[model samples]
Target: MNFKHMTAAAVFAGLIAGCNVMGTPLPDPRLSGRDAEFMALAPQARVNSQFERYLVDYKTNEPVGSIIVDNNAKFLYYVMPGGKAVRYGVATGQDAMAFTGRAYVGGMQEWPRWIPPKDMLERWPHLQPTADAGGLPGGPDNPLGSRALYLYQDGKDTLYRIHGTNEPDKIGQAVSSGCIRMRDIDAIDLYNRVKVGTKVVVL
Candidate 1:
């Protein structure tokens, strides 16, 4: 109410307005217009765990048919010809008792509509019977992200997916309930290279 108090309040407000507070910086504004980076399949050029790195099969490994999931490392290796493999960051099951064993890529979908499973509804009472309540449209927010590869075994849905996530930061971690997650761009790239009936081995 006093002049001194008002002045202090104004300073504080200006500080916030000028990004003085310590917090996560917003995603790059320049990157916002680059929707293709968030939506389209692009080449993985970097190496190691860096954001730009995408492991590809080389030498003896080259998506030779066998796929191995190093869940511990949060990396999926598609064994390629020679001695090379395509390593990809992935978001795996949150629980230690998550998906294991073998499966195949039964089908693929783009910007697939997500339908919450019955169990998900049971666990979250607020969840609706259909995806409309929480399901995000096929775009930036969809949990399934830009692309999805349906995992199946013995001609049955494993209730698991090897898909893309909007939260690329969560990649290379154990976070999802029961899905193999990757960055949206990386997933799109992998989707194009893989096909139906590709055997996947998750360890």
Candidate 2:
């Protein structure tokens, strides 16, 4: 096997070994820096076992670098070679606001500034004051958290994104306006993995 395949095998083995052992908790694959300060400040949430990253027996026609959002399952799968995928928990849009169909990752940003969309401003008029003053700066209080992957279709901005959130507790629930939400650490991990032009399928 090539280097990539060998690396995947090692990761898969580690994941399998991490399952349900009665000792220390498995190291979270998503958290890069293990920032204790950030963890202390971030909202605490109980992450279900299914939401954690694992080596899944995913069979898909899509090539590597594709993303599949299973809305019903509240899971996001990043397709990998060798019939494997890295699954993550995601919070999707509410029933009427959920996005379906296909798009591609058009752009990416780190600690992105959030400009509240016009519709959002109309829905939450209270934000109009901030809307008048440019946009929210990137920080722990910013809704966009640490990373963002902008979605597009036919090279036009879809105004949807997969991004990190300040409120990590909302993950695994349908609470977003239209974009997908992930834990800040998970978002950072995914941001490092994917590139612009990655295909995304929302189902």
TM-score of each: 0.70, 0.81
Instruction: Give the per-residue lDDT digits (tens) of candidate 2, residues 1-203.
Output: 24465677787777667663322222454443534445446665677767756557688988898999998888898887888777888999999989999999999998788989998988999998787888997766779887899999999999999998898778889999989998877887788889999999999
Query: lDDT (0-100) at residue 111 of candidate 1?
Result: 69
- Tell me model 1's lDDT, rounded to 2 decimals: 0.69
Which residue window of length 10 is worst by lDDT in model 2?
Answer: 20-29
Error in Å for residue 7 of model 2: 37
Report lDDT per candidate: 0.69, 0.82
Backbone clash tally (model 2): 0
Top lDDT hit: 2
Stretches of candidate 2 off by over 4 Å are 1-40
Which candidate number has the best TM-score? 2
